[model samples]
Target chain A: MHDKTIAEISAGLQGRKFSSVEVTRAFLARISQFNEELNCFITVTEGEAIADARAADERIAHGTAGPLTGIPIGHKDIFCTRSIKTSCGSKMLDNFYSPYDATVVSRLQDSGMVMLGKLNMDEFAMGSSNETSYYGPVRNPWDLTAVPGGSSGGSAAAVAARLVPVSTGTDTGGSIRQPASFCGITGIKPTYGRVSRYGMIAFASSLDQGGPLSRTAEDAAMLLQAMAGFDPRDSTSVDHPVPDYRASLDDGVEGLTIGVPSEFFDQDLDSEIAALLETTIAEYQRQGANVKEVSLPNVGFSVPVYYVVAPAECSSNLSRFDGVRFGHRCEDPDDLLDLYTRSRGEGFGAEVKRRILMGTYALSAGYYDAYYLRAQKVRRLISQDFHNAFEQVDVLVAPTAPSVAFGIGEKTSDPVEMYLSDIFTIAVNLAGIPALSMPVGFVDGKPVGMQLIGNFFSEGRLLNVAHRYQGVTDWHLRCPNGFE
Target chain B: MDLSIEDVKKISALARIEIEQQDIDGYVRDLGGILGLVDQLNSAETDEVTPMAHPMDQVQRLRVDQVTEQDQRELFQSQAPQVEAGLYLVPKVIE
Candidate 1:
């Protein structure tokens, strides 16, 4: 039952082949059997899930159900769940229960999707590896010793291990795509402003965007269709038209002009991954797609520019956790200053505090123009690079990550080394464009993902292209060993 | 430019995160390494480019002055550590 894709399950539910409760129970059982080993879930709402499923069964009987009516999805633990622990994998928020639901959570609930649990992630969505999570590191389902890339490690792992059909994830740098790649599943980060940020717990407000991680593009599109839209609650949420993501999924990539950025294939990329990408592109050619070489020269500067801009925004956004309104607070204090410092110090982990400090320095009086302003201007140049590439090609193809998942604790000590893992996926966020990562094949017995980047608001086209590719390839079909 | 312990101390204080004496050395090293990584951006020429504060080019949205939110102070304060009589409690500031 866990082997079925969301589309298959949706059909089964609508056809009355089985009730939603049966599907939810099978997944809950799988999570119980495997979560102790994978550590993918932070909280499991079993009673609520069963109740939600029972309601969906009634809705189906009345013939008033939507496409995602019975899907069981996991929140990334970053999005607030009303009266539930939306920890965001941070001790700061561990004791915090939001008074209301995040826009994404409510929208999915409205769609009749059952909430399985809150997925684990990097504390405040800061780390490229899942080790920074206060709950503990999430293990890659493929190899227990290796990490499932983060900060959406648990989101990807849950879907990959078949504990759930899909789960939510937010991408700042490579949070969603990298983990999806490592876990050998599909994930998409919609255009900036495509999803509401209200109650999502801002990390870097300008860069963070929520989407879905699923076993296939069809499932991602189904989940994304429900998650994307405008919200008056989030000032940054764009009032753009939400298209039917499944409408064009079967639209073949015949004569499609696919761009291969030269910079993405530079010396820093792993040779084995490059060879695998070349072969994957050749498969597209056989399906009547044209490949063209393009350049995003300014794309290489993305990581450095992102490091400054993201932290600067984080420092400002995190100031709200001052032990007053909500969240963790110190036991006792001599003065206001003591209260503020100790509360935050005890609440945040090393990575979160380091970013806060980095942001503080960047936004300080004299350094503002040098660090923050200059990085923003370079960010413009990176966005322009994407603008130029899109003029010649319908989509740009690149490796989602430089390599397969590394062993846990390998790069935790070195922040820069960890940041480099997101080298390929950062520029897309800087440009505020939509990109999707789909499993291409494997290297060193671990899975690899190739990214499909498109111009702004082009999620449907990207999903269509990936869905067509999934039809031809079976790499995404292979589940991790011992899971079955 | 490497960040000194003094620089880290100042930054930590400004950020409102207390760093004890033992962790200052590690913070100094890691913060210095991070700043060093971002220093590579100095090479990019952005004199002609406009700074993009956000990915989308738009102005802030404004609505009529009618209040849309209800008073959820009691529910919201349920999670706070120190609250009394519908007010958040804090350390004394006045002498």
Candidate 2:
């Protein structure tokens, strides 16, 4: 029962095979047994989970339950849950629980999904690996020594370990997709404005977007059905009507066009990853997908542009943590400046500090035009490159990461090496397009993921490609060793 | 783009993060490598292209100005390090 897909779980609830309490308890037991070893969860809300599960059972018994009535899902610590600790994996907000639920959490609650607990993440969603988390780094369920890709690393690790059937994750600059790839799970980062960001603590607001991480693409589709919608509180949210994501699972690539960027296969990429990507592309071609070579000439400079833009926004957004309102404050200070300086100094981790400095430099009085303005211009060029490619193809294909998950702490002391891991993913955020990472096959003993990117509002198309591939292969369903 | 230990210290002070002297050299090297790669944007031409700030070009949608939520100050302030009667307490500033 614990290993069944979301669709199968929903069917079981409809058929009265098992009660919601029974299923929720199974997940709770699994979490207790594995969470200490994996360190994927920040807090477990067993009390709330049981109460919600009982309510769901009552609803289903009365024939009033909806699609996700009995399914269990976990929220990334970044999303504000009323009366629950929404730490964002930072010591600053370690005890800060919001008085109201985030719009995404509210929507999921409205849909009757059971809440499991808060998952761990990089502090303020800043790092490429989960090593920067204040609580501690999340261990990959596949290989404990390997990283679980990051910021959303905890969400991916939990789902891959089958602790929870599905979980929510936010991607600012590859947080969702990269971890999903490293942990061998299916996750999507929807286009900007597709999901509201009102109460999901800001980390580069223009780039942050929340989506789902699950064992299969079909489960992601169902989760997205509830998570995607416009809210008045989030001014940037799109008012576009939600589409039925499951409607096109059978829509295989009969005449579909997939763009393979020439620049993505450059010399800087690892040879093993490049070879694995070729096999995945060849699989699509065998499925009748029309694969064509596309060019994104300006893509080579995406890392520089992202570093400038993301840091600049981060410095501004993170300013609210000055110990004036609701987070960590200094023990004692002689002056307000001392309070501000000491609080922030003690609150943030090394990576967060590095970004704040870079951002401050980029947006400084003398360097604004040279750094921020120029980076914005380069961002436009990168977006235009994707637009031109999309004109010739429906979606683009590439390796999710340059290589499989590296060992924990391997690149922590070197920030540049860590930043390069996000090379393939940063451009998608810059272009504000929907992208997903699905497990393709294994490289050595670890899993590798193939990335599929689509034009804005093409989440349905991206899921269709992933779901079709997952139906024919066993990669998405493979569980990590020692997880049972 | 080559950052020195002094530069790292200055940047850390500017960012308001405390670090020991031993860690400064490593930060300088790491930041320099990243800045070195980031400087490539200088050669990439983005002339004649309008910078994109947001993905959609939708006009601003305004809502009527009104309070939609109640002030739960007590519930919210409970998480603060120091709080008073409906206000957050902090160290003295001006002597």
Best by DockQ: 1
Give the Cα-based TM-score of candidate 1 against the true structure: 0.99
Let me know the DockQ for model 1. Answer: 0.89
* Candidate 2, B-chain TM: 0.84
lDDT of 1 by residue, B1-95 (tens): 79888999999999999998999999999988888889999899988889998888778999789999998888988987888998889987887
User: Which structure among the candidates has the greatest lDDT?
Assistant: 1
What is candidate 2's lDDT per residue for A424-465, written digit by digit as tens?
Answer: 999999989999999988887788988999999999999999
Worst 10 residues of 2 chain A by lDDT: A332-341
What is the lDDT, from 0 to 100, of the residue B66 in candidate 2?
Answer: 90
Scored by lDDT, model 2 comes in at 0.89
Q: Tens digits of per-residue lDDT for model 2 on B13-85?
A: 6766666677677677766776777788889776787777887756678999898989777877777778788
The reply for model 1, stretches above 4 Å from the true place, is: none
**Model 2 DockQ (Cα-based):** 0.63
| True interface contacts reproduced, per candidate | 0.93, 0.65
